[model samples]
Target: MTDVSVYTDPQAAVPTAPLIETRKLTRHFRVGRGLSPKMLHAVDDVDITIDRQEIVALAGESGSGKSTIARLLAGVYTPTSGEIYFQGRAVSSMRSRRDQLAYRGDVPMVFQDPFSSLNPAFRVSHGILRSLKLHQPELTRTQRNEEAERVIEAVGLAPASDLMYRYPYELSGGQRQRIGFAQALAHKPKLILADEPVSMLDVSIRIGLLNLMAELRRSAGVSFLYITHDIASARYVADRLLIMYAGHIVESGPTEAVLANPKHPYTDLLLGAVPDPRAPLSVAVEGDTGEPPKVIDPTPGCRFRWRCPLVVDECHHVTPTLRLLGDGHEAACHVAEPDAGMHATKP
Candidate 1:
């Protein structure tokens, strides 16, 4: 078995090195059937890091390239440019089959769709047991079944024997989702890239899954890159937050701090849309007015400029770089003041 030293101690002092880091990671797809094909900037020059035992929530609306980032991290889609590093080792440079397999074993993904992620032909235990076979080939059949049952119970599926034989079709949406968590847990991975794992489940069940993930992080010393559009849930579970818009991370900071005082206009707009019980019923909701800009052949400026209420001439000319606003807080907006105040600008 590969020694996963990175996830050894949960209570130990935080390590300076990042477990997973991406430097200017970008992925582009060529579309249109012509000599001059357009380029879709699915992920554009984004930098992110996930430290050991940390839950970083990547929140963005649909088509904001959140899932693409998750896929890139999971080694599903190769990046067109830039780099991904796992435990300080460059992922692109891992040539040996052993090293590649070790990396995959250490970085399992919990996909969004519980219904389709598992095959209908096989029982729940078969899926997890198959993973155990590949990762732990030395284990005997009895040991493997015991480990499978333990993992199924760990994911909150009680009476593991009953669930072990059931097909994907027989389980409820929540049960299938728990089985998804169990499959990822079976690998004993250091990092889990959960891409909207609870969006399809009932609202009541979402908290249960999130709690299970938190428990895994605490007990097993696992790191998570949680991708979702739901800000409320993100705030509840994440320690830090990254708000993405039009393929760019516009704002990032401590979850509570960012929620209480957002620096970027886009972030403010998102917070405004969230229902507040204290606010009057007649309170007008401010939202993004226009459609998102075309990622294909994108203009050389801030992507949110077209829909921004505080648009200015400078926004149309120069792309705003992500700059530090305060302690650990960053924003990529020209008019965002350091203290979360809006800078007046000409339209």
Candidate 2:
């Protein structure tokens, strides 16, 4: 039961097409004090396709490598091995820094921390002007300023003129986030990678920001790759949701379908862990945070076996593949048949 409801837009005018694709992508890092340090398989083998004008959320617990995947797709880090394709052509094959720059203008990222990305010393106008000059330098001084102010207003930084000289510290969290968004949208980028864009904002402001993003998608056809740890919020904003665990997508498909009829044990645990108003403090997640499992050089079986309650001896011997079960829904589990019944009751 692939929940395709969140993605089906009757208003979209163009035939659906994939804008970005990654094949067998992988990234590994070596971390530790010893000269011969332990390797961290931050991003294991992953294949993904993002369609034009569609927002697909990458949701998982922190450190599941969702951020790594975001960085990889945005060209921030080249994949250790595998191919990255944008609009059918390969990224690594592209020659010349100018061509790369052109491609980047079409694909920009909005970071999680507004402070980390925005300089504290510069005024809001100065920040936007710098990006405009870098990406659209042909504009005259007046043209660039006008364009900057127009975009500022478009992203809902009200009294856009009034905020022109304000520094990062002068603005509220929500207002600062709006500026980051305005800068990203200034390029008129076709694809936007938002890494937890709303996590730092207040809950009320989060909805307003989300509503703005939704409007942008429908009006401008800007596809979003939203990375976040909030499942319910993902359901609200994403057309499709990819659930990642231990650097692997254990389950993925439409948000409603995957959330309602979760097939993987990890998915169930994740949803159960969501903060529910009905349960309040009783909604627990994995007992305690404790130390996460060390998956580098892990055995070939289920990486989640350390936490999966339904795990059996066979689960530790053979790794599960991301097999398509029905419709568009897919899962990497031994018992993921579409018609199979739930193995046990809720925790």
Task: Score every model by TM-score.
Answer: 0.93, 0.90
lDDT digits (tens) for residues 1-347 of candidate 1: 11122346343223566888999999999999868899899999899988888999999889999999999988899999999988777899888887777778788899999999999999988889998998889999999998898888877887888899989999998899888878888888889999999999999999999988888888777889999989999999999999998888888889997888788888887777788999999987765586676799898889998878887799988988789998788999988888765522224
RMSD (Cα, Å) of model 2: 5.4
lDDT of each: 0.85, 0.80
Worst 10 residues of 2 by lDDT: 1-10
Off by over 4 Å in 2: 1-17, 33-35, 280-291, 340-347
Candidate 1: deviation at residue 143, Å?
Answer: 1.1
lDDT at 70 for candidate 1? 92
